[model samples]
Target: MNKSLITNLVAALLLVAGVLLNNTLLSLVGLFALSGGLTNWLAIHMLFEKVPGLVGSGVIPAQFEAFKNAIKTLMMEQFFTQANIDRFVSGQDSQVHLHLQPVIEKVDLSPSFDKLVDVIMNSSFGSMLSMFGGASALTPLKEPFVLNMKQSLIELTQQESFIELLKNQIDQPNVMAEIRAKSKKLLMPG
Candidate 1:
């Protein structure tokens, strides 16, 4: 049922018929087909296993360390370079947009509002806010405050310093070492 099995079967039949009929050409063709199929099978097997007396076998597992290093080098050199990161961050296609809507939506600003009320109560405006029911008077400003904070964060990310800071962090020796360690663990997990 396997392709190799079928090929071997046909080759065997050809060889048998050639020998019984004394046909040298058929015999040669069958031998070629059999050898070709066997060679292909052996090559495929050698890729993942070491065959005795075969050179360059078991390549994948044997050179796994080298492969890991190569991958790390490739990523750091080609993908994570400062210029490449800056290009991607500042690209006109807008492929990278910093969205903080979900974060802003989940934030509880009540504690902050209460703190603000405390500061205001201790200040000269304490008497004025007392008539307005203290911190509850600021409840109406929560939405606008959150929206302004989110907008400010988005604007900050567009600044050159933000991109430089990101690049600097990624380029740090410790961060790069940590990345390599994680990648090695992933490739050769015990």
Candidate 2:
């Protein structure tokens, strides 16, 4: 049995015993206990059910749309605000640089070297290059090129214009609309 039901039952038994024994104090205590238990039970019930003639009952179902709007507002205004975005970007700067190392390591500079070789092969250096090892001579430069590119990218991200551009893109009206639409779809999920 529910705790409230057990409480009410005990309260009822106390009231009956008080009446039989003619004790006013016991009767009053019983009445208070009964009233408190019943009121708590009724309030809980009102949260889920529409009580007849009772205003604001079944509140969860009644205010579901408002709840969804509140969720969307909280997500967009509080969580995705400009200040929050700036904080996140600032925090990830070092992380971004670290992650770029693997990408730089994976880069293949052979194609670029081949193109350079083709250009040189067609120029005045063509005959002289034929004596040299051609594109294979550029293999030693790959590590330095990758390192320079990575450093350049890290420097680019540190610029104020780069952060400002990111903020502008996130703050765009279309982007906000798309976010709102996706949030609604996630919450409602038809």
Q: Report the lDDT tens digits of candidate 1 across residue range 1-190.
A: 8989899889988888888889999988888888888889888889889888889999988998899789867776776665555555455335664554466557776566567768888898988888988767877887777667666766776687876677666667676666656655664567
The C-alpha RMSD of each candidate to the native structure, in angstroms, is: 7.3, 9.0
lDDT of each: 0.74, 0.73
Give one digit per residue, the lDDT tens place, for model 2 in 92-122: 4344222344565576755665676678778
The clash count for each model shown is 0, 0
TM-score of candidate 2 versus the correct structure, residues matched by position: 0.39
Model 1 clash pairs?
none
TM-score of each: 0.48, 0.39
